[model samples]
Target: MSIKGQTEQQQAEAQLAVGYYTELFKPPLEPKKLPPPAKLPPVPQPVLAQRVPGAKEESVSGAWQIVADKLKEQILLRHYSPQTLKSYSIWMWKLSRFLENKSPETVTTSDVQRFLADLAVRQQVSASAQNQAFHALLFLFRYVFKRDLGDLRDTPRARFQLASFPFRD
Candidate 1:
């Protein structure tokens, strides 16, 4: 073919190629059947009072479990730090043990006082440790139990001990 004829033929071939490519994007005349989406199994929720490894199952069961679950819900709802949740969980567990699994409804300010005193006088925990315990318990009573902790003026205060240095002349 002459150069002009060859260019015309090439343009016609290009047009055909473009038309074929555009057909790929056009909807089919007949509807095609698509398989339904696969059904997924429901996810299991985490148990807040799940058993600790190598520990008795009873340790996390009973009334304490109810309190633990509620405490976790409250902590998560407020968007508190994980450390706060961990600290609160430990204090709640300690409180449960101290109360001998007594129902949270039965817990009183006096009970809290005694527990604080026990931590200070016997456990000899540092002031910061006792304060953290106090705050944890306070959060428990206020949020989890939905009750005010009331007056704790008589609670034995944990004393901060300063390091003593030997005097040199």
Candidate 2:
């Protein structure tokens, strides 16, 4: 009621908080004291969603340069860094060529696995690079190519790594 009666913060808080609570439903449950939620770094969304549909289409002159080109365009239009466009384009180009200038629909899933294996064994690329190429190719099929890559039967199995058992000694 008077300036002497309460601190200004308390008075302001009281004024702001007035009539904020209801008396009609007081206590069937105790007020829950929840710990403040942990501050979490936002989960980065999957990058594959950036692929644009209707961009990839059949090539009139040859295999679809436009599909791979448009994917580059879409990537640029979305302002993705230049590095992503470079990496994706490299894989896209290789895959389209690997299909031997055929329509995407004409290609089978086995072709992809074969390509990867050949890239590893024949081309002598590292496993990580093969995996990167595989992911890039997958994004093309799932998003740009817009169809099931169809039971990729040649999935490389987990290779056995030789290790000596400690108990054997």
Candidate 3:
């Protein structure tokens, strides 16, 4: 337009025309503040497992505590892995809970069977977990309590679902 000798007024007008059309085509601005988020119901906090009457304080109270300590000692003496120690200890605690802090000496194979059944039927634990719990209890009975927990009868086994494999060409 300058080379063709258009006036300064003419060039300004042309730019203003383009600007007007751009403004007309432009999308409207989003609201600065979204309507205050919908009022939400208060979320409930998770309830922790309530402690059994005699389960707390491993020393001076629970008889299971003494057996638990012995189990730990035996596990350590055998140079078992930390994971093994933790799992065994956890299973022992669970047994204590199941028994309502009763003496481990009184726990027969039937009790173990019931606990394992609860894991499978009630708690719905996986195959490996149920097996791990079984082995842990086995160790506790055989070594710690010095009782033979022979043949846990009527024990519910955890059902493992195997994934179907694809055939290769």
Candidate 4:
């Protein structure tokens, strides 16, 4: 091709390359709109009833239900895992039954001690289960009830058993 024709073709190619790079780096004309946060369904309140065998049917108070709801709220607000929430809820239900659904405000440290002892002695719960219960109660009192759980030094502890292997020398 002639020199002028070649020069025009080079200019066109350079413009095309510049256009491609500019489009590649250009910001989007409109920012993406994210969907609104989903609303969580309301949690159902657990019924407190005498679950022990041969225990007389009694109408316990619903005070513990309020505490459980508060515990759930605190756990959700802190962004804790769903499993942690479920564990805490189970422990709280057990505790409420042990306390005969007593109002959380009236619960004393001794009551907590007796409950822990009962788990160890009567229910024979595993060490990890007992520990989870302890932590759940601690969180309940600390956050939900806004009270300090006093010394439980004398509470009976659940024993941890080692897994034995028959082939071990």
Candidate 5:
């Protein structure tokens, strides 16, 4: 065939090939529509002022209650462990009970000394327990109540009696 006729035939074949490929590659059908997003219940907002430990103490009238709330605030503000908060709160309760629920403002170093002495001499708590109580009180006085604990020299020490345990390898 002539070059002109061959070129026309080649163009027609190219068109057919392109049409075949387009039909082969075409998408099958329309996709399924997506479901609408589910609506969620509204969340309640927290009361910012009441969330603070100090603000929650408003209804508490006792001196120790106010002091305890302050202690909790300090412990939380410093990011101390929850165990520390629990221990300190326990010791504070014990101290209040020991003082016959006296005002925290009126408690002095002597009061603390008596409490510690009672733990050692009367309650017979272990040295570690006594030390734990001491630290709790220390944090209370120095940080919470903002008072000096003074020298704790007069505080009685809890004596320890070691017991030997038999072991075999």
Candidate 6:
């Protein structure tokens, strides 16, 4: 190849390398702050919401912070398992969203009952799951909310309880 051709090839390769590096280390695009009917995008960092451990206090929406604060106590006091923590957290999250961030004190038994009903009918979850979720939510209602639900047991999943079966010949 001629000198000019070789120089051009080297220049192209250098440009390609620079382009690849630029693409690799590119900064994340700023979220679009579009107008109405569009979301403003999440705040990115964990805002205060509440006085969390080792976290600065910043304004945040939702009841999660309060629920989370209570969660730590439950774990420390009752020694809930990690799975239970996650499950209970999920229940609280649903409840918060359902109530549209209403104060826990404002959550009525009817709200909880409706939520469970919706879970069974709309989500079609299994009996064990439904029961577990109910218990978790109940815990939040009774202990966290300091409220009563009064005999709002989940409708048992219908199943025949056969005492015994004949042995095969």
lDDT digits (tens) for residues 26-99 of candidate 3: 98798567688553222122122874344243332346667767887888788777778777888877877776
Itemize residue pairs with steric clashes in candidate 4: none
- For model 3, state the Cα shift of residue 28 in Å: 76
Full ranking by lDDT: 4, 1, 5, 3, 6, 2
Judging by lDDT, tell me the better candidate of 1 and 6: 1
Give candidate 2 regions above 4 Å deviation: 1-62, 77-79, 157-169
Provide the lowest-lDDT 10-residue window in model 4: 52-61
The 0-to-1 C-alpha lDDT of every candidate, in the order given, reads 0.79, 0.63, 0.76, 0.80, 0.77, 0.64
Error of 3 at 19 (Å): 76
Better of 5 and 6 by TM-score: 5
TM-score of 5: 0.61
The digit string of per-residue lDDT tens for model 2 on 72-155 reads 666656676666667777777676566544575566678888787777667766666777887777767776777677675466
**Cα lDDT of model 6 by residue, 1-169, tens digit:** 5556677778888789999999998986996676866322221222224444422222223346766677646654786666676667767767666655556656787787877787677776666677877888778777766677666765434233343456677
Best model per TM-score: 4
TM-score of each: 0.62, 0.50, 0.62, 0.67, 0.61, 0.53
Clashes of each: 0, 0, 0, 0, 0, 1
Question: Cα RMSD (Å) between model 1 and the true structure?
Answer: 11.0
Report the alpha-carbon TM-score of model 6 versus the true structure: 0.53
Residue 107 in candidate 6, Cα distance off native in Å: 0.4
**By lDDT, is 3 or 6 better?**
3
Error of 6 at 60 (Å): 8.4
- Which 10-residue window in model 6 sums to the lowest lDDT? 39-48
Against the true structure, candidate 3 has what lDDT? Answer: 0.76
